[model samples]
Target: MEDAKPMLLVLSLLVVAILPTLRANIADFDEVWKKRAEDAKKASLEAYDPHPERVTQNVNEEVHEALEGDDGKRRNLKKYNGPCTATNPIDRCWRCDQDWASNRKKLADCALGFGRKATGGKDGEIYVVTDPSDDSLLDPKPGTLRYAVLQPQPLWIIFAHNMMIKLSQELMVTSNKTIDGRGANVHIANGGQITLQFVRNVIIHGLHVHDNKAGNGGMIRDSFDHFGLRTRSDGDGISLFGATDVWIDHISMWNCQDGLIDAIMASTAITISNCHFTHHNEVLLFGGSDTYSDDKVMQVTLAFNHFGKGLVQRMPRIRWGFVHVVNNDYTHWLMYAIGGSQQPTVISQGNRFVAPPSLFAKEVTKRGYTPESVWKSWNWRSEGDLLLNGAFFVESGSPITNLDTKDMIPAKPGSFVARLTRFAGALACVKGKPC
Candidate 1:
C-alpha cells in the first residue's frame, strides 16, 4: 500500500470540496439534484411520447442535421458523410441496409474501436441452424448452432426459424464466424453460455441470450480441428478470452450466472452496441482484474444500448482499459451503473441516467475498493450527458483537453439518449418490415 495521507488530502480538497460545485455549480446540492430529477422525468416523458417522424424516416434527421451544421462541433462525422448518415455513428455504418441479410458482411465494416474489422465469416458460406438442440455437445451435427460455430472456416450462421435453444453445456465459438439471428426469433436461454477464446474476427448480433448457468465443463469442441477439456463456466452470456476484433450487436440479455458480458485476457478492439440488459447483478466486466495490468490494450465502445430494470452494478465495471460509453439510456439500477479500478480511462457521453429511488444509490459510479486518492487520479469523465432523476456522476481525473474529446458531438445529452437508444434489444423483423 502507498502512503495515502497526502492523496487523501487531495481527495478531500478536490472531490469532497470543489467537486460538487464543479458538477452542478450550485450551493444547495439537494435543490440542484431535485431540479435534475424533474428534468429527467420530463425527458422520460418526451422520450416515450410517440414521434410521428420515426415512422416517416427511420433515423433521427434532426440529429443528423445538427451534425451537418458548420457550428464546428460536428466531430469527425464529415469523413463518413453522404451515404453514411445516421443518428448514431455506429448505426450509420450498418443500419442502412434494408437488405441486411444479403449484405451481412457490411456489419463488420461498421465497427469502431479495437474490433473494427471483425468480419466473422463474411467471406465464407452460409450455415443455417435448423436444429436448436445442444444434445451432442461434442461432434454436433451441421444443423445445430453449436456445430455452425465450431467449423474452422468463416461462416455466416442464421437460424432457420423461431426457436429457443437450451444448451447442455457452454458453446465454444470458433473464429471467423458470425451468428446472425436477424430474420428469425432466436433465444440462447435455459442455462446456455457462449465462449470466444484465442480467436479473432467474430460478430454476434440480434439474439436474446439469457438464463445461463454454471457449466460443469467436460469435453467441448472448440473448433473443427480440435477438441479440448475445460473448467467449469461461470455462465456468462458471452465471455471473451484472449480474443480480438470481436463485435457483438443488438442483443438482449438478462439473469445470467455471472456478468452478462465479460471480456478478459487482453481482449481488444471490441464494440458492444444496440443491446439491452436487465435483471442482472454484474452486467459487463472489462479486463480481468487489478493484477492484469497488461489489459491496458483494451479499447471498447459501448453505444446505443439500454440498461433497464433490475440491474445492480457494473453496467460495466472496468479495470485497466479505455472504455467509451456513449449515447445510451440507463433507466434504472439498484447499486451503481459504472465502476472500475486499476486506473482505467472511462469516457461517458451523450447518455441518460435515471437513478433508482434509493437515496444511498443515487451516484452513478463506484470505485472498486480503492482509497479516494488513488481512484481520484483515474481519467473518468462525463460530457454532454444527461443526468436526471437526481442521478449525478461523480467525476475526477484530468479535464478533457484534446481535440478528439473536445470536438465530441455531444450526442450523450439526456434528450438525445431516448432516440439514440430507442432500438435497444432483439428485433422482430419480418421480411419487409424496417428493422
Candidate 2:
C-alpha cells in the first residue's frame, strides 16, 4: 500500500509539470481563434452593402430643382434671408425657408380668400378652420376675392377628427405664416390620402399628426414621389422638408410608422430641441435621396431631446450632411443609434444609451426573429462581436465620426424611469431652459 501511494504521488507531479506546457499550447490556439474572429469581422464589414439602389438616387437634384428652381442657383433675395422668429437661438433662416416652401400654396389660397369663412369677415382676414367645410382652406373657387385685410396674426387651422377637412396635399405657405394647433389632442386622423407639396416659411406646431398615412408604397418616382412613397398612414407627427432655419420644440411623437421628425433635400441650419420622441420608426432623419449632392444639406443640430421606449426602429438615420446630435437620451432602440448613407458626416456626442440584454431579447422576440438573423439581414454586428473580434469592428465603414459616449447617463434595461431622468437632464441643457 505504501509503495502504491508513492507511485500515485509521482504520477500527480508529472501531470502538474506537463500542465503548463498544455496551457501554453492552448494559448497558441487562442491566438488562432482571435485571428479567425478578426478575419470574420473584416469579411462581414466588407460584405455589408446597403444595396444603394434601395435608396432613391439623384433625389437631391430633383428636390433641389423643385425647390430652388431650374438653374440650380439659389436666389439671394432679401425676403428669403433673415433670422427665424422662434425664441430659440438654434432656430435659423434655412428652416424658415423650408417651412415657407412646404405650405406656400395653402397660404396663397388663404391670402387670396377662396374658402368659406366659418367666421364671416373680409377676405384675407385671419380665420380658423374648425369644421369639415374648410375645404375652402385647400382650393378656393376661382375669382375668390383677395382678402382686403391682411391679418397681422398668423392663420390657425384647427382640425378635429369630426371636422372632415381633408388638408392632405402639401400646402405652400407664404412668408410670416404660422399655423398653430391649440393642443396636442387636436387630431388629424388618416388624412394621409392627400399630398402636401411645395411651399415655404410656415410653422405647424402643437398638433398630433397620426394615421395621416399617404404615399405610394416604396416606389421610386420623382423626388416628390419619394415624399409620397415614404408617406404612410403612419407618417411623422411633424415633418419638415426642403426648408431651413425651422424649429420644432415641446412636441411628443409616438407610434408613428415613420420617423417622428425628418428633414430632407438641401434643408440646412435647422434645430430640433426640447422634444420628446418615442414609439416611432426613427426619431429623426437628415439629408435627401442619393441622387443629389449639395453642400447646403449640412449644418443641422438635434440636441437636448429625450428618446425612449416604444421606439421599435432606427434612431437618427442621416446622410450627406453635418448633423450635430448631442446631449440626448436614447433608450431601447431596436437597431443602431445613428445610421444612414455612407456619405455625410454625423457628429453624435454627449448622448446616453441605456440598453439591457433583455431589451435586445424583447426586440428580437417582437420581430419573431433571432439576433443572429437580424444581424445578418442588416449586416450589423453585436456588442459581443467585439469580444471575438477586436474593437476595430466599430470603425469599419462607419459614417459617423467624433462619437462621444463618455459621461452618458447609464440606466438598467427596461427601466423607463431611469431613461426619463437621463433624457430630462440632456434636454434641459439643450433647451437652455427648465426641462
Candidate 3:
C-alpha cells in the first residue's frame, strides 16, 4: 500500500506535465482548423464539376481510339510496334515517354475526371525520400517521408530506391504535395495508415498500401507550422477528411482493417483511378454519417479501376453527393455491389459487373436506412453497364430526357472496359524504358 502511493504520485506528476502540452496543442489546432475549414469549403465549391460526364465521355473516346484505330475499327495487338501499349489516356500521357524519370512533373497534368485540376506539387521542387523510417513525429529526419509531407511548401516527393515504410503513427499529409512512387518498388504495410485532413491538391500514385493497423495517436506534426494532439486513428488505407482536389491512382491494396479508402466530412473533387482492390470489406465509403448533410456537396469519380477477387461488399457504398463510376472492371463480389442511401446521385456508366455464382447476392444496388417510398426517388442510373451471370442494377428516379442525355450518356459501352483496364494497378517502370 505504501509503494502504491508513490506510483500514483508519479503517474499524477506525468499527467500534470503532459496536460499543458496537450492543452496548447488543442488550442493551436482549433485555430488551424477554423482556417482550414474555410479554405476547404472555398476550394470544394470552386472545384465541383456539375458535368463530369463530359470528361468521362472524352476519356472513353480516347480509350476507344487507342484500342481501336481512329477509323473506329478494332486492331490486332499482335501487329503493334509501339514501345509501350498504353491502353488508357491517362497512362498514354506519360507511360511511353523514355525520359519520364527526368520529367516526372509531367504526370501532374495526366489526372482526369473531377480531380484533373489537382496539379500536386507540379511547380514545386523535387524532394527525394532516402529514409524509410518514421522514427520521430515531432522532429522527423530530413530525408524521410514524414518530413517530405510536412513541409509547408509544395513538393514532389519521390523515393531514392526500393523501400518499405512502416509508420509508427498516421501519416498526415499537407496540401500541394505529391507522393509519386514510380521507378521504385515502395510499400506501406503492417503499420499505421494515411490521413489527409483539411488539405487540398494532393496526388498519391504508384504504390502498394496494405495490411494497415490503427494508430494510437499523440502529438503528431501535420505540417511544418502545426503539431497537434491527435486521437486514435481508423485503420483505413487512406482517409480523406474535409479535403479537396485529391487524386489517388495506380495503387494495389488489400487486407486493411477499415474501409480501403474513405472520403468523408465534406471531402470532394476527388478521383480514384487505375487501382486494384482485393480481399477487403466495405471497400469504399463516401459519407461517414447519414446525418452529416454537408456531404451533399461531395463529388467523386471512380475510373478505370479493377475490383478483383475476394471482395465482399460496398464497392463504394455512398450516402449523399454525385458520383460517376465509369469504365471500371468488377470481376468478383460476394455481396451486393454499389450501394447507397440519403438520396445521393450515382451514375454508373460503361462498367462490367460479373456476379458470383450465388443467386442470393446478384443485385448491384443496395439502399440502406430508407424505405422503398423514399429511396425510389433517388437518382441512381446505370447506362452501358454489362451485367453477367444474373447481375442487375436497380435504377430509380425520373427517366433522363434528351436534354439531360446530351450531357450524361456519351460514354462507350462496357465491352471497351476489357481494353481500358488491361493495365490496371501499379506498373513496373524501368529507367530509359517504357512502363
Candidate 4:
C-alpha cells in the first residue's frame, strides 16, 4: 500500500491535466450570463413583496366567506361544472376543454403564481417533431426535437408519435419555446438531460424525464445562431441556470444523478406544478450556494405536486429567496423535508405532510447548520397544513398584517390535496377529448 501511493498521485495529476482539453471555447459566456443575471434580478425584484403569500391568503378567505351557508357550514363552491372534474384551479383553467389538442397554446395562459406571465410560444407557429433521435449535438436534422428547440423563432413544439429520445448531449433550450408532450408518451431518459440556461418564457409539460447521466463537456448549440463549449453537466433532470419566467408542469421525474430539478444562479419568477417525483435522493434545489447573495431576488412557487415514495431530502432546500409551497402532497421522505439557509422566506400553506416511520426524523423543516440565534428571525410559517404520523413544523418570525389584496389569486386548501393532485404526473391524452 505504501508503493501504490505514488501511482495514485500520478493518476490524479494526469486526470487534472487532461480535463481542460475537453472544453470548447466560447468567447461570450461571461457576457451572456451577466446580461441574463441582471435581467432576472430586475424582473424578480419588480414582482417582490415582503409578504408575497398575503394575496393568496386574502383570496382564499374571500372565497370561503362567499360560500358560507346560513347555518355557518361552508357550502362547496363548484367553479367548473363540466364533464371532467378538474379539482385544482390550475387544472380547471384548461383541462375541461374537448378541443385542447387543437388549442394547445391556451395552456400557456393558465399558469398561476409567479410564473403566471410566462407565455411560452403563445404567438408562435406549431412545430411538430417527427424524429426522436438526438444523434448530433451540433447541426441537427430539420425534423428532430433538437432542431425544433434550437430554432431562433418562437415555437410550440409537439411530438408526432410516442418516442423515447436518448440525448447524446445536454438539450440546450432557447427562449420562447414550449415543448408540449400531451398527445404522446415522450420520454427523455438514459442520457443527457434538459438545460435551460440564460433563457426566459419557456414551458415544459407532460413529459417523463428520468435516469439521466452526466456528459463529458463538449461543443453544443444553445440557439440557432450560437454554439458554445459546455462543462460537464451535474445530471439534473431539469436545470434552470439564470432563467426566469419558466413554468414546468406535469413532468414525471425520478432517479437522476443530482437533484430532480435545480434553479440557481439568480433564477426567479418560476413555478413547478402538478409533477410526480419519486425514487430520487435530493429532489429540488433552489439558490445553489449560500454566498450567491444575488439570489435574494429569487421567488418561486411549488404547487400541487405529489412528493411520493423513495425520496430523501431537499424537497427544496433553498437559500436567500421567497418560496411559496402551497397545496403539495408529501407522502414519503427518508430524511427531514423542506430545508433552508441564508435567511430565506418560506411560506408553507395548504399542504399535507405525512412523515416517515423513522423516530429520529419527524420534523418537517431543517435550517441547515445555522444556530437558533441566527435563524430565529427567518420567516418560516405553516398555515393550514395537515401534519400526520407524528410530523411537526417549526415556525418562526412574526406574521404580516393588513396586506393589500388589490389584485391577488388564492391558492387552494390542503384538505383537498388528494383530489387536487389526483392527476399529478403526465397524463395520457387523446386528440379530441379533454385532457
Candidate 5:
C-alpha cells in the first residue's frame, strides 16, 4: 500500500505540470482558427471587387459622348473663346464719344434728326419715347410719354436704371426682347413692386438683381413677405409666378429674405443649372400651390450645382413633382436633403455625403454630436444605409441593390471638386466652358 501511494502522488504531480501546457496548445489552436476565418472573409470580398477608377472612367466617357452634339459645340467654343461682345451702333458711337467729337454743324444736324425721329411726323406716326433718355422728347413730366419702351428692346437700355424707368405694376412686356446684361452689374434700387407676371419665353441671363429697396406695396409685393425670408432675396430673386419655360442660368444670389428662386402655379419645364446658390434658408422651391395634379409633375432638374453652408435646411421642399437632384455637392449644413409631403418621386443619386465622423466608426465625437444623432437628423438608417469609406447615406429599403465600395470613384478633399471631376465633361459641354 505504501509503495502504491508514492506512485500515485508522482503521477498526479506529472498531470498537474502538463495541464498548463495543454491549455497553451488549445489557445494557440483557437487563434489559428480565428485568423483563418478572417482571411476567408477578406478573400470573399476580394472576389467580387468593382474597380472604382474603371467605373469612374466609364461614367465620364458616357457623359462626354452624350454631350458631344448640339449644346456641346457651343460649350467648347465658349470655353476656348469667351462670350461674344456686340452692341448697337448708336450706343457704341455714344460710348466712344465719336458723336460728340464731330463739329457743331454735324452735331446740330444729328441733334435735329434725333428730335425729328423722337417726335413722329405730320403723318401721325405717333412718337413714343423708346429710350429712357428720350423722356426729354416728352413734355418732361412723370407718366407723360406717349409710349414707354419695355425692357431689352431699346439698345440704349444697358444698365438697370434704364430698365427700371418703365418698370411698373401695370407694365406688360408685349414684345419679344432680349435684355442682355453684357456681363455687367445691373442694380435695381427702390423700384416699387416689380413683377414678371404673365411673361413667356423670357431669358434673364448674366445679371445680378440685388438690393431693390422697392417697397412691397404696389401691384406686386416681395415674395419674402408672403413666404418666409430664408433664402437670399428681398422678394424672390426671380419668381416664375404662373410663367412657363423660364430658363435662369449663370446667376449668383445672396442675402435676400425669400428663396433664391421660386417657381409656382403650373410652371413647367423649368431648368436651373450652372448657378451658385448659398447663404439662404431654402435654395430652390417647387409647387407653391397644388391646383392641378397633372401640372404637379413640372419636371424640375437641379444638376451640377453647389448647395451648402451659412444656412440651415437648404433643400428643396418639393411637393408633388418629379425632381431629379443629381451630381450635386451637399456638405456642411443641417436638416434633410429633401423634406416634403405627398407622392413626390425624388431621384437622389450620385451625390457625396460627408457625415460628422464616419459611417464605420462606433462613435463620432465632434461639435458635441454623435453618429446616432447625426444619422437620425439626416434621416439615415445605418442598418439599411450602406457606408463607403465612412460616407454616403441612402434611404432605408431603397431599391439600390448594390453599393459596391470598390465601384465607387475616389474623390478629392472637397465635394465640389469631386463632383466636378465626376461629371466634368458633361458640365463643360452644357455651360459652354471648361469645367
Candidate 6:
C-alpha cells in the first residue's frame, strides 16, 4: 500500500504526456470524417432524381428499420424464434417473418443508398412474365421478360413459372419497374445481358444471372416510344448508364463475359445488396471513365452481398464516387480486393475478407492505375474489418487511429463481422415456412 502512490503518479504523468497528441489525432480524424459525411449528403441531394411520376427522397435522411427503432434504438430479434433473426441491419428490416411473400413490397423500404426511394411498381399493375423467349429485339412478345420491362406503365413484374430467360439482345429495362423473380426459379443466362441507360426507379431481385454474352446493339427499342441505333454491348451481367434510383438485390451471378455489374456515366442513387457473386473477374465497377467527372455525384451503397469464389479484383473498383461498402463477405480472390482511383471515397465497414494463399497478393487493397504520389491522398477507410488468413489492408490517406469520441465510434468490433455477414446472400425460402 505504501508503493501505490508513486506508481499512480507515474501513470498519471504518462497519460498527461500522451493525451495531447492523442486528442490532436482524433480531432483531425473527426474533421475529415465530418467533411466526407457532409459532402456525401450534398451529393445525394444533388443527384436526387426529379421524375414527375414518382417521389424520390434524400437517401441520407432515411433510417433503416433494422438499424434503428421508432425512437432510435438498435434492435435485434431476441424476442422472436426460429432461423435466428438476421443480425445484419438490412436483413432484419424484413427477413425473419414468415409473411415475406405477402409483404414483398416491404423490401423497397429497406433500400440504403442513393437509390433508396425506388418503391418500384408498388403503385402500379402486376405483370407476369410467362414466356422465356426474346425472339425479336424490335418487337418484344407480350408474355416475355423483355415485354414486361418495355411497358411504359408502372408495373410489379413476377414470373408465372420456373424458367430460364435467354435474350437475343440486351434487355433495356425501362423506368419505374420492378423485375421480381421471387417465389420461382427465374434466371437470365447465356443471354445478351441487361441494360439500364437513361432510366430511373428500377429494382431487380431474386434471379440467377450468369453466362452473359455481348450483344450487337442496333436499332433496338429502349422505351414504349423510341428505338435508337446503338453499338455493341460489352457483355456485362448488368449495366447502368446514366440511370438513377436503382436497387439490385438477391441476385446470384457467375461467369459473366465482363463485369457482373457496371454503373457508369453519372449513375447515382444506387444500392447493390444481398447478391451472391462467384466465378467472375472484375466483379463491380462504379465509374466507367476517370474523365467523366459527372460521375462525381455518384453515391452507392453495397451491403449484405457475398463476394465468393473465383473472383479476381475490383470488388467495386470505384472512381470519383462516394461508396459505402458495408457488411459484405469476401471469401476468395486470385488478386487483391477493394481498389480505387481518381479520388473515390470508400468507407469499408463491418466486412470480412479472407485472402488467398499467395504472399504477394494477401493485401486487401490496391490503388488502380495511379501512382502512389497521386493515390496517396484519396480517402479509403477500413473500419471493423476482419482480415483473416494472413490478409492485410494497405491503408492510405489521413490516418484515423484515435477515435475516442461518442458520435464517431468506429464501426463495431472486427470480431463481430462474422456474425454480421453470415447471412450475406439470398435466403433459400419456402412457402408456409420462415425465411
Write out the backbone clash pairs for model 1: 114-269, 115-269, 349-412, 350-411, 350-412, 350-413, 351-412
- Give lDDT: candidate 2, residue 57: 17
On the 0 to 100 scale, the lDDT of residue 277 in model 6 is 93
Best by lDDT: 3
Worst 10 residues of 4 by lDDT: 19-28
* Global lDDT of model 3: 0.84
Q: What's the alpha carbon RMSD for model 6? A: 17.9
* Tens-digit lDDT string for candidate 2 (1-435): 987998999999887555432221122334533443354334323322232211111211222232232231222313322333221212221123334423322322221000101111212234444443313332332221111112233444432232322334322232234443432144444543221122223444444445445432232121211111222222544554444434444455566445666665444445455456666666676654554564234445555466767665445666565554544555556554566553554434334555434433222111112234332333222221111111112222232211232222221112122221222211111112221
| Residue 22 local lDDT, model 6 | 26
Compared with the true structure, model 6 gives a TM-score of 0.80
- For residue 81, model 5's alpha carbon misses the true position, in angstroms, by 14
Q: What global local distance difference test value does model 1 have?
A: 0.74
lDDT of each prediction vs. the true structure?
Answer: 0.74, 0.37, 0.84, 0.81, 0.36, 0.74
Ranking 1 against 5 by TM-score, winner: 1
TM-score: model 5 vs. ground truth: 0.46
Clashing pairs in 4: none
lDDT of 4 by residue, 256-347 (tens): 98889998877888889999999999999998888889788788888889999899999999999888888889999999889999999888
lDDT of residue 222 for candidate 5 = 19
Could you tell which candidate, 3 or 5, scores higher by TM-score?
Answer: 3
Provide the RMSD of all predictions against the true structure, rounded to 1 decimal: 15.7, 23.2, 6.0, 5.1, 27.9, 17.9
